[model samples]
Target: MLLALDLLGIFVFAISGGLVAVRNQLDIVGVVVLAMATGLGGGVIRDVLIGAVPPPALDDWRYLAVPAGAGLVTFLWHPAVERLERVMNVFDAAGLGMFCVAGALKAHDYGLGPAPAAALGMLTGIGGGVIRDLLAGRVPVVLRSGELYAIPALAGAAVAATGVELGVRPAVVVVPGAVLASGWRLLAFRKGWTAPAPRVSPPR
Candidate 1:
């Protein structure tokens, strides 16, 4: 189940990266490279932080293949893919939820406390997007757009970490954690909600 979720997240994120690369007028090589980077960047960061050397993304052929395939598909069918932007957004939310929950659980397994685990979890959810934006020469959406992205990831990670700390079965906590993050993200998108922004005074 964990592996499946990770692969799903990677595939979806890779497609997103490919789309961004295409929109930025990148070559096919750039599209594939960006896709692979976005797909694996977050998990690699989490693994390195936890001292899990040679992260599964590096070790597993399937992990490498999935993102490469996604990138190719996106490059070939981008117009169709672009037409399904809303559907892609839904998949992106699912990817965020899965990554956050999985990252937190992995951190906990590595002896991290709830707070640290939750922090890493949120990183796992947003790190790929950050790298994607950077590679595409844009400011990361999570950092600049005031979208309800990181908060929901943190919320989901917190729920999973706290539940496990309190002795809940890992399997049992997965759904609620994932649902909270993804559902909240979907709601925010649907409602045109934005995170709170600071008010600025007008220049004299």
Candidate 2:
């Protein structure tokens, strides 16, 4: 179940990266590179942080194949994919929810404390997007756009970590955490809710 969720998240994030590449007029190679990086980067970072060296994303062929396939599909049918931008955003929210919960669970399994596990989970959700934006030569949307992206990830991670700390079964814990994050993200999108931004004083 965990592996399945991870792969699903990878596919969604890969498509997002591929779309960014297309929008930037990148070639096939660039599209594929961005897709792979965006899909696998976060998990790889989490794995390394928790001493799960070699990262399943690097060791497993399935992980590599999923993102590569997503990249190719996006490269070939970008117009159709781009046409579904709003729908894709919905999927992206789901991916974020799953990724964060999964990350927190993995960290807990590795004996990390709840706080660190939750932090890693949030990172696992947003790290890939940050890498994609940087590679695409743009500020990461999570940092600049003030979208309710990372906060929901952190919230979901916190929920999962809290559940595990209370001795809950991982399978049971997954649903509510994921739902909370994804549901909140979808609502934020529909309602135009954003993170609070700093108020800059007008120049004299």
Candidate 3:
């Protein structure tokens, strides 16, 4: 179940990456590279941080293939894919929810304390998109956009970590945790919500 959730998250993230590449007019190779990086980058970072060397992504051919397949599909059918931007955004939120919860559980399972595990979980959710945006030469949406993205990821991670720390079953926590994160994200989108920005004075 966990492995399936992980791959679903990777596939969604890869599709988002491929979409970005297509929007940027990147060639086929670039599309695939970006997709693979976005799909695997966060998990790789989380694994390395927890001292799980030689990350599973590197050891598993299926992990590599999923993103590559997503990229190719996006590259070939981008026109249709582009038309589904709104739907894709919702899937991205779902992916974010899955990764954050999974990351927190995995970190806790690896002997990390709740706080650090929660932080790593948030990283697992946002890290790939940050890398994708950077490589694509754009400000990360998490940083610059006034949208409720990272906050929900952090919320989900915290929920998962806190639940585990309190001796709750991980399986019991996963669904509610993911629903909280993704539901909040979708609500924010539907309600036209935006995060506050710092005030700036006009130039004299």
TM-score of each: 0.96, 0.96, 0.95
Error of 3 at 129 (Å): 0.5
lDDT digits (tens) for residues 1-204 of candidate 3: 767877888988998899899888889998998998899888889999999888999898989999999899999998998888888888889999999998999999999999998899899999888888888999988898999988898899999999999999999889888999899988999998988998988989
Clashing pairs in 1: none
**Stretches of candidate 2 exceeding 4 Å from the true structure:** none
For candidate 1, what is the lDDT? 0.92
Candidate 3 Cα errors over 4 Å, as ranges:
none
Tens-place lDDT per residue, model 2, 9-72, is 8999999999999999999999999999899888889999999989888788999999999999
lDDT of each: 0.92, 0.93, 0.90
Highest lDDT scorer = 2
Evaluate residue 34 in candidate 3 and report its C-alpha lDDT on the 0 to 100 scale. Answer: 90
- Report the C-alpha displacement of residue 90, candidate 2, in angstroms: 1.6
